[model samples]
Structure formats: C-alpha cells, structure tokens
Target: ALTTMAKWEGGRAVDARAAETGETPLMAAASAGQLDCCLSLLTAGADPLAVNVDGVGILALVASKVSQGKRSKVRAVVRLALLNAAPQLRVLLLHHEDCGRHISFKPHQESPERISAILAFIAKGATIGLFSAEELLVSTEFDQASKEHLIRCHSEEYISVITQLGEQVANTPVAFTPYYQGFKGLPQAKQKKAEFSDTFFSPGTMAAALRAAGGVVHAVESVLKGHSRTAFVCVRPPGHHAGVDGATAGAPSSGFSIVNNAMIGALHALEGNHGRLCKRVAVVDFDVHHGNGTEEIARAWHAKHRKAGARAASGADESDLFFASIHLADDGAASSIEFYPGTGTRDDLHHNIVNVCVPPMWIGAGAGGRGSVSA
Candidate 1:
C-alpha cells in the first residue's frame, strides 16, 4: 500500500499521479464515504488533511461533500482501520506521527450518521415522531440536549475520565479490543487514560448520550399525557448501569451509565414542579441486565422530591413505582430488594437462568406448559 501510494504530496498532486486524478485514493475514499479504504490509506500513508486544487482535503471533502448520516459509520470504519494497522497508539487522540496529521488540521465534528447508528441500538423501544414529540409544537431530538445535559450531569472526576476518551476518538480511533483481558477485567485503565489524554467529555464526551436519554423520557411523558403516542431517544452510552454510590466490578454497567440515561428517562416520565421531578412512573427495563442504576436513582429521586402523603411509604416502598427488568438474577438467593441486589453477581451473569431448585423437563407445570396441572 505504501509503495503504491507515493504519488500525492504537500496537499497537491504529483505529475505521474496527476494523470490518475488530482487527488489520491485516500481523498477519493473520503468523498465516496469509503471509511475503511480512507482510514487504511491514511494509516498506510495517505493524507487526511491533504488538499488539491479544489481546496478539498480528505476530511473537508468528507464533511462537506459526502452525504449526511453516513459519517459516523464512515468514522467507525475509520476507527477499525486505524486499530487494525497500527501496532500501538501512543496517544489515541493525538497521533503526533500521522503523515497527514495536522498542527492546524483542526477537529472533525461527529457525523450525524455515526451518532444515529449508536442511537438505533440504544433507543430501540422509543417511538420517533409521534409518541415522544407529537404533542409539542417542536420535535425534541437529543442533539442539543445531549450537549447540554452531559455538561450539567457529569461530575468533574467523571467528566475528566470520559473527556479523555472523546479525545481518543477525536485524535485517532482506538482499535476495538475485547472487554476482558484473556480471562480478567476490561481494559478500563487504558480506556480511562486515553479518555483523559484526549479530553473526550469537556467538549461533550458522554453528554450527547445523556441528552438523548433525557429527551427520550420527555418523549415518553408526552405519550403518557396523551400528547404523543410514540417517540425515540436516539442516544448512546446506553445508561443502565452505574449504581447509586458509584460503579463497581460486579454489576454490569457502562462507567458512563453512572449518570444513567434510562434513569433520566424514568424521572421525566413523572410529574414535576418547582424545577424538581415528582411523580410515579414505571420503568420497563427490557435491556439484558437489571437496570440497577435507574432503579437506584429513581428511588433516591423519589425520596427527595415525592409529595407528602402522595407516596405510599416515605420513599422506600417502590411497589407503586414500576421498576422491572428481564434479567438473570446474579446475587444467588440474595437477589431481593431486602438484600439490595445492586452489585453484580460474583459469577457470569446467567444468560438463561433455570430455577434448578425446582424443575421438571419439558413436561412443564404452568402458564404455557405442555403438561397437565397435576403431576
């Protein structure tokens, strides 16, 4: 790839390559939204910041010319390409060595397309236009909210952490590695280090994901109020983890989820007054894991702001506030409210939890059972 790519230079096309095209393959790939090709070429020696006679550098062409919404995908491709080729990234955000690396190259704004792909997975249950945004004169998307909420919600310690990740995303995409180290914990320290070195959150690292969550809940409220019937909060950092105190090893959670988007959604589902959230709401947590953070935070929020005599208990009994999850209970027999089963199990959170204590084979006993009522 390197030997074949010796033609382009100094933001201008060389004569022999000029016959092929004024720009190189890398530049062409950007325009075509061939993110993989572009990233590969760039990593292999193509110029990300190179420009030709048309005042079009590879990044510029991608930003201005390529179609919208495909940018993130293109970027995701770009990230993959970077990771696959480079043996090591000294600074995931600042490649002090990319030939096309720019002192004045400037940062690239995230493409809506890339953001949307993440949104699709994160906000699967939300209804886009009607349920969430129909009643209001304006449609509430999380783009701006994402930017705003994160700035407000995250702690300085937390913000600093994610901010660095964002920087890594900005500078050079990290190669995707498995969550575990052969047979151990995730590469969190590396992730955290990159996040800090890169300044990910300061400019809106995890905030965008937060905004989408809050916005989605607001949409849900609109529906419950008979305003809209459906809507979706296309957001990320899918916030279902992050328990009340802080994140720990056992429970499965995104460190980002410490602030939790779903919890925000549940809060907005309720009625609020005096700039405070107040109401009874049900959080249908269908995500694979039990949404402990949402449950934890909602309970806390209720304790502080719920109306006097309005709630059944002094905020402890959340039977009225629906928080249910279709998850395998990890805490063995300790998985109960009394036990506060928020921490993750000391084992592989079961994928299929069979109540082995009492069971028969396919000759089932209840509900959709195939057998007779009596043994």
Candidate 2:
C-alpha cells in the first residue's frame, strides 16, 4: 500500500476526499477495518484531524468501528493516528541562570521566587501522573531572539537604549541621569530616566528579556511546523504592556515590560520567510490589567495588512489579526480609583479589536460582565 501510494503524488492523493461524503482515504480505510491501509495513508501525510461532512473527526469514526467487535483493529488505527497527529504538549521554560534574578519589584508581582513556585507546582503535578512524562516535552535551551526579531515589535532606538541601560545598571543605579544621558543624549535622557523608575532593570535583564522573547518565538514556530499541536511558553518580564515604542496607552512607563514578546511571535508566524504559515491569528488576553501594548500592535498589524489589500483568511474585510482584551474597568463613581494603564473600554473597539471591560465591583454570572464578553 505504501509503495502504491508513493506513485499517486503523496499527500495530495492520500488526503483526497469523497465529493459526496467528504471522507478522506484514511477515513475510508478506518471505516473498512483496513488497518494496514490506514497506516499507509497516515505515513503518506494523511491528516488524522480531518473531519467529514457532519464534522465528525477521524478518531471518532475509527472508534465507532469498535461496535462491530473489531476491538484490536480499532485500537491499532487509533494508536497510529495519535502518534502521527502530533498531540503531545510542549512547555518552554527559561534557564534559571539566564532569567533575571534581580527584577524583584513588589508592584510588578514577578520575581525569580514566583517562577520557582510555579515550576514546583507543575513538577508535583507531573510526578502524580496528572500528565505523563512521555506526553510532556519541556525544553530549557532555546536561542535568544536577535535584534531583527525584537525590532519587529519595537523601534531600533528603543531597543538600543534599553540594552544600554540594562548594561549600565551594573555600574550605576537606574536613578543616575548622567549615565543614561550619555547613552540617550541630553534631550531625551530625562524622560527615559523617569520611565525606568516604574520597571526595575539589572545587568541580567537584557539576557532575560532576549530569552523570554526567544522562547515565545520558538513555541510559535514549533506549533506551526507541527512539532506540537499546542505549546505553553513560561518566561519572565511579562509582555503585553510594552508597545511599539516601549510605552503603551499613554502610560508613564513601559508597564514593567521591556519588549513585546507575544506580538513578535504573532508577526513571525504571520510573515515567515518563505511565506506566511498562518493567514489568521487571534490574541485573547484575560488579565487583571488591559493589554494595551498588544491591542496597539494588533491594530497596527491590521491597518498595515488592510492598506496592502490583504484580506483575512475567512475572506472578510476585518484584519487578519484579531485581538480581544478582557480586563477590569473603572467605575464612574466620584470616589472610584482608575485601574493601571486604564485602557480597553467598550468604546475603544475596532473592526478586529474587542475590549470587554468588566466593572471592578462586578460579581457572579448574573452581572452583565459575562454577557459583554460573550457578545
């Protein structure tokens, strides 16, 4: 079967479906209890995740054959599909020595200690068989993102200034204006000096930031290349707050973020070297504070693609990149204090942007917050 399939133009032939039923060759083989033929089709690049006209997947079709008591035959086909479908989960972790050990700002709520606690919890879960070791791929070593990758979501000058400041923090406190002026020039030095006050930086910050951004990039590429169906990237100096120019949503600082890693990864997947691997991508951010930087970047990406006459993957007028931010909103009461960054309102929506703002005092499903998000 494998030899015959090779002569039929490979994947195109193996995945060909019936016009009336929308069943691929793999589905037909599984339905007929031809285990050998199913294996051959999978090896020839048949997609096991393909569905029929009723939207029933190949695995369900194979499992249905078990009702005929062909139990062993059904099991064989299911195992083969699972192995070929890349169903394993990939978890990307930053190296302990590389992740910044000095970014311990109390307000930011992120530190080396927090990462250690999270890792311990995940390790405990894995030990108890919450997930099998065979199904979990944990990678600690990954390439640091280059200047080009960082510049995709940030300005070259901002990148340079931040890099210099991170290095200078070793010899001088971030409070030193003269040292910062030496790198950024006198005119912009004062403004840049004040921005760093909100976010702490150390000698290890540059390395940690690069690695964090790189981990996200690697995760995106791995999923697109079919190495894994899903991936979770665990890195530090949280993104989603840093915009193209570093500060976001008129915030006084970069919102404790040095670079926008998520936007960089999204753009990388959308605009690969050979061609785009993904025509449409969505970033759904559910955080206490609004992801102003992510929203800004998504808006810009849509505008750029729209200007170039590029339509969405669904052939809609909306941009290829869709961003939805669900975050806490400030109440209109006189005594109500505004939240951090204070953006992402219902009125701030765009064609591809969804800002679902939940009031600070909102509680339970009875509240309209859930409905706003659902809509």
Clashes of each: 23, 0
Cα lDDT computed for each candidate against the true fold:
0.41, 0.67
What lDDT would candidate 2 get against the real structure? 0.67
How do the residues 214-257 of candidate 2 rate in per-residue lDDT, one tens digit apiece? 88888888778766646777777778988876766456566667
The digit string of per-residue lDDT tens for model 1 on 1-375 reads 543453346423322234434676666665676655555465455544345667654444543445677665664454344334432211111000111111111243322344445445434523542222111133433232343343322345554444554455554333212221111345655343442221112234334544555566566555454343234444443466654433434443243342566655554444332232435556666543455655455555545444443543323233345554544333333222322233322211111111111112232343121111221
Clashing pairs in 2: none
Those runs of model 1 whose alpha carbons end farther than 4 Å from true positions after fitting are 1-143, 146-204, 245-258, 271-279, 302-320, 331-375
Q: State in Å the error of residue 170, model 2.
A: 1.0
lDDT (Cα, 0-100) at 164 in candidate 1: 52
Cα shift from native, residue 288, model 1 (Å): 2.1
TM per candidate: 0.38, 0.73
